[model samples]
Target: MFTDKLREGSTGPVAKFLFIIIMVSFAIAGVGSYLTPKMDFNPVKVNGNSITNGELEQQFRLEKNKLERQLGKAFREQAKDPAFNASLRKQTLERMITDQVVSDHIFNSGVVISDDLVKNRIREMPEFQVNGKFSDAQFRKVLSLAGYPSPLVFSEALKGDISKEIYLKTAFDSGFALPDDVAVMAQILSQERTFSKIDIAIDAYKKNQTAGEDEIKAYYDSHSKDFLLPEKVKVSYIYITAGDFVNDVKYTDEDLKKFFDLHAELYTIPEKRTVSHILITGEDAEDKIAKVAEELKGGASFEDLAKKYSEDSSSKDKGGKLPAFAQGVMDSSFEKAAFALEKTGDVSEPVSTQFGWHLIRLDGIEPGHGADFNQVKDDVIEQYTKVQSRELFMDKKQIIADTSFENPDSLDAAALAANAAREEGGQVSKSVQIKTSDFIANGDEKAAFPLNQPEVQKVMFQSELRESPVNSDVVELGDNAIVVVHVEGYQEPAPKPLSEVHDQVRDAVLTAKAENASGATLKSVTDSLAKSESLEKYVKDGLIVISGPATISRIKTGDVDAQVASNVFAMPTPEPGNITYKSFAGNNGSSYVLVLSKVVDPKLGADSARDSFLNNQIYNFRYGEDNQIVINSARAESKVEYNENREYLKMQEEQNN
Candidate 1:
């Protein structure tokens, strides 16, 4: 809102003194050294601050890597989908923008993370530590590998994450729903609907009628478009894999070392604590805990006390041994006590938690650190060689696709250039309609080769066949594999001849006529009931009356289908004299006449695990809503200019979930 400029080179002492103070103030705030890397493209700008394409690309890479790791080969299919990729890219961009907005808010609000805290946080990070202690050399090497130029850049980013976490923690912990909130959720979860339903068996109606040959033929003629065949393609293709190039690609020892140095962070593990406790419960729990605490003070073994007094059977037999885990797994009071111990065998005073009173001990601590280069050189070399091959493969993938696209006749030229082998692949539809295994004879396995799967079956069907067979765009199979196909033959889609589909047409016609006849009866019966009273008289004539869940909550459906529950909940509460009635289809080939019977209020008497769990869920939900509100409101209020060229991205993101 403000900008300062000296009045035409004024040489006054006051102007010089004011300039000095401004410099000193910025130095004190530690903002003088904070530098954001320069980027040339701005896709999103908020309040005059540009969020560059480079920054968004980095976030996109991180998100893609995470998806690939989790989903494996399935992610390749999703990545190739235009809708999925567009949505993912937009989400990644928006999330990064939100983070930037929050970071800027933190800075403007003067919520500073001290230099000392940043130092401690960096020291504590497992990635940059060596043998549980901070290593400057290790830190530098790891950061450089991750593309951080210096400590200042990494530290500033880390500080932002920490500051945002602190603020969110405060917000999350402060949220508490009113007593009515629990009652509302309980009513939704536990509400019961007394419903009267009637199943119309299609078979009963079909028994009196049979579909004639002429009728089946007429039905087939009308729905001919539904049976249209998918286009098929025949091609000869060569497959190139990283494994095929692994032995051929040469790398020096120095190159292996360089690869290892850059990716050092991958080797580190987080600090873990293995602690055990003797849990005490029931009326004499405190007395038992006190006794155990006393025994520990007298140098009595924790294992012996645990075995004698522990009520937890899972660990008591093994002297209260618990598997190692990082913090956040245990109950809060227990974790606080356990993590407080400085060394192995350091025991804690008996701590009381939701589980029980307990005597705790720190069995061991494994300090996290990156391994030195010598310890993992061979494995690193093998992995790095694969990485190089994948890189080489990616570069050749486009060349193969383009060369085949231009040539259109055969894979011979592309195969020779890409060092791939040419093999014949069959023409098949987009699905498992044609099985490769079916083509193989039991005794002639050596002569049968499995058909190559196209990159995207949908795209293959979508692309038109040229007079001269054209090359397909490269289809990537996960990270290391890719293939391009050239059409050798094309098959046009046509309706199936009636003789082969006669049985299917007969079944379809029977089902259609039966459902239509039964549906008319159902509609007439259900409609008349609204005009008359006493549904019980019709109960003996095969009407099914089922009671809905007792009390419905958002998370649980007691007896009714979730869709039924949701529809009913959305309705206005009925007056005492007039009960609400809704008619709908049931899961079975049936119709339903539902009445909202009652709603139950939740009764959470005294504090218990159930209460804790419910409150935690409520808190998290509200916290998320609160976060969305604040961030969205802030974003809405800010003047954001989006590049028109990239607005297609926003359109795709609007398809969220």
Candidate 2:
């Protein structure tokens, strides 16, 4: 899809930026001084450029976040494993080292991006824009949120990415698909197969099969470890959440008024202005703007002139009408010009912004308003409760954490300390209480809230905590919810007696026997088919059912078993008027003897659109392969040094141990 867009000349600055995002580790484009070798620990050095421990950690966090989002709930279990985190860190470090090597190569290659291109790309980025135009305030606000000290820092980072993008684009262009490649892809995608299946149900094979006492005993003895119960723990804990204090928060009308007065600006709505413009950009913009101004001066309808000549594609079709916007949402110059208009239908002199020159006209305005005390009393009470509860929650959480650690044997002191903190904050005291949990076994998904939380489960089952029995360090269930647990009772894993597991062991042995019987039957059928014999006798005995012949294509493999369909297309084509047989074990304890009777190769069509699509598909695949090769080659040739004792990396190892 991306290759097609690129070929069609539709890929622009935004696409390029998305394609090669800034490599955060080596983004010091103009800030070379920050890259000077320091006494600080380095995790890896690529071609004399050191990747600091801090940079490695930052990149690791970003990569981890991306993975968590991509994997969603499935990543939660993996995140609890320290080993997975260590592996992620190693991968992150390797990527950063590769980026550093690429950054060095780009710098040494003398690639220079023109100033105008950089400025234009920056202005085009949606993150730095408001109302479809560049906004200095939004740009700086995003930079600050992203932890960049200033615009220069973020711009330098962006410039580095842009430079690397040049090299990547060249690499991508090196790949091309020939006519033969397109033909092959089209054939593979459009080929069809017709096959029949001999279905052998495992249960049918197992009808006369049975496991004896000896077989059950043997299986039980061999897999005793699998029969053991998981270790279990019952814990008493005291937890605090922001919501816990919400009801206890008492406030008077005077207090609400005080809060309302303190945050008066937040309650005031900013004035809104509806405006339109004729934007003249690109070659001879000044001349175009002057022409627009002259036409407007000659009593030309502003809307008509805007529809005729405005270069802002987003608004031109609507007579250059922009959505009503308040302060800080438009280019500073544009906002000033529109707001300075004295009345509706007033036109302003031509105004200039980073985008272009524009003639502005005000269409309508909505004056700002502030709510009186009584008008928003309910809102004030809710906001005040939220603020007070959050403060009290944090205070109680701190007291609980400290008290719990000091008195590690019980949650009583911790609970009392939390209550005291609430009392001190003028909240209802003794609302916080210690709660006991039912015995929670390892990997127990049914455990109730707090216990069901993996963080809490991890602490509850700790060897030290279970044996020594201490109040656990505060475990945060979420941003504002935390719990401190003390082991009240514990049980170690133990094997179930053979007598108690006799039925389970017998079932396991019977399953194994059934699987063997099913395999033997499939083998017998395959051997019979190989000898040009038929399964008429077995079919009569009801041991096998032959499914009707069905046709399948790569794009339309209708109603066929997924496993059967996958293997059907991959099987070698038989000679004309010959049958081929392949056997497979089904996921549900069944077996299949696939009878492939025909293979249809796609005939090449004269469809130009489909040919282009196939060509682009192959081109994209080749481009990705070549891009990876370039990166791999750079990595293999780059001189990289690893700091085995970097303190940041050591922490992961220590945690896993």
Candidate 3:
């Protein structure tokens, strides 16, 4: 559920806007804002604001960790490539630059976020909340764990983020899609283009693309790093789950009462009303409703009068009866009248609403009530047991953490210490057991229980743990589970021998050769087409096939090659009696030469759903584009400089080759 919420928070305009602000806050704060002092190298300066190397390194690590958690094994593979690492570093620095510029712009624009708002925002985050309410202890604990020396520094960083959020919200909210704008966008998006494609399959070039033994061997020797086995680890762990202490908990009647008193709202059910209404709409509804109310006051059976006079088709036949409903679920006026009744069978006076007039009768009332301790004793005990069990779990968790840290080499001491503490507390629970796992590779999706979790994987694969096989710090799997893992076996990545990977190297060499041939073929074809050579000759000679002259829209391209269709639609339409030609390589080892023949703009008919979706898409795109333009303009206008000699930014000599 938390993962889903985080995913949701990473999407849409406001979420994305807040995400950027938060990332900026992280870049500025660098986790331990209070502890960070002056640094020697300032990696970059935005609007004369220096971004120190220390801050950049921290931000880089944060981004790298987030990416690893998100991309999992894919990121591990990419990390092997020096180019990928270089690009990531550059991208991280660029993000910091963008953030600094945007922050400066927002503050200079006179946007203000109050201290109260910042405090409230912090309070609202789930990380600092306990039982749906903000906890000061939790807040301090989380911040301390996150390496913030104090709340003041984090608050300062948060204020800046909140200010940016307010500025972005105003900017985004100021723009909206007009009907005319939406119509024009719809016509353009739904516009059709007629184009022809010449597809040169790679097989034609691959026929003569063979690599000699020496060439294959040379490639294998040079690119040995690319064909390495992933690093693997086997771990032994001791997990403490909440259930381990639940059976050890003992609760009395007094304890249950205390728990019930503290959480009475949890057991309290909302008041509900089973109501019936005679709705009189149309002309003279007021007089008609009054007459019905008068008849009800005259002691006529309310149901009979409703059946005879009510005009609500859905309820009139059923004696104007409605399902039981609670407050906030009915029309305001209707709910007001229905809930005001003191007892069942009470009839309300005529009430006016947008639906005209309603004369309501309360059929029954289920008044909201808080359960007494005796009434919900079992429930109270269950909750009490859970609370005590969690408290006990925390106690044991602390012991495990201390003992594991002290031992550093094994979990045997941690388990014994926890169970010993449990027995000292007069608990009769089973001793915690040490569980061993099969060899798990870095970011292995198939890793079994406990190890399957990303947080565990992260700690298990930490370089320090691999370098010196030791007990890791306690990792919380969720609210109920905590674990301490120790590396029992570790394997470093090594290149595959030529004897084992010869076929793979030969395939790579052939693929490279085929790619080169495809590039050459594309250049020759493009040159020929540019020189006004007839495409009919290539088709007649069976060198390429002409796929389509079919008219296709952006969303409705059918059977046309994806790359060909994409290029065709993206290309500008030619003037009358002229054609535009574009050449590009296909992802499927083929080359494409596209001819855009004609364009047509066709307006869409009235479709509320499609129109709404398109309007939102257009609005989001334009607003996001506007925000980006603002950042770009600011960056361009700002005095931005980078440290040329920064070690992290430079590619290693080996990678340079």
The model with the greatest lDDT is 2
In order of listing, the candidates' clash counts read 13, 0, 0
Q: What do the candidate models score in CA lDDT, each in turn?
A: 0.64, 0.77, 0.76
Best-to-worst lDDT order:
2, 3, 1
What does candidate 2's lDDT look like per residue over 1-657, in tens digits? 988877666478775675455444346453354566444467667787788777766766656666765676788567654446666777887777776776666676677777778889888775565444677866775555445556775566677779877877765564567877778878888888999889886566667678888888889889999899889999898877788988778888789999999867557665688999999876478898998899889989888998999988999999989999886578988887787786888888889886779999889988767879888888888889999998888888888879988988898888877776333455448768999988889889798876876656877888888778788877655335677788989988998998999989887887788787767778889999889798898888777889979999888888887878998877778889888989876787666888899999867767655776777678778767765775777777789987665553443333231
Q: Give the TM-score of candidate 1.
A: 0.64
lDDT of 1 by residue, 584-606 (tens): 77676556555654544555454
Of candidate 3, the 10-residue stretch with the lowest lDDT total is: 648-657
Better lDDT candidate (1, 2): 2
What would the TM-scores of all predictions be? Answer: 0.64, 0.64, 0.57
Worst 10 residues of 2 by lDDT: 648-657
Which of 2 and 3 is ahead in TM-score?
2
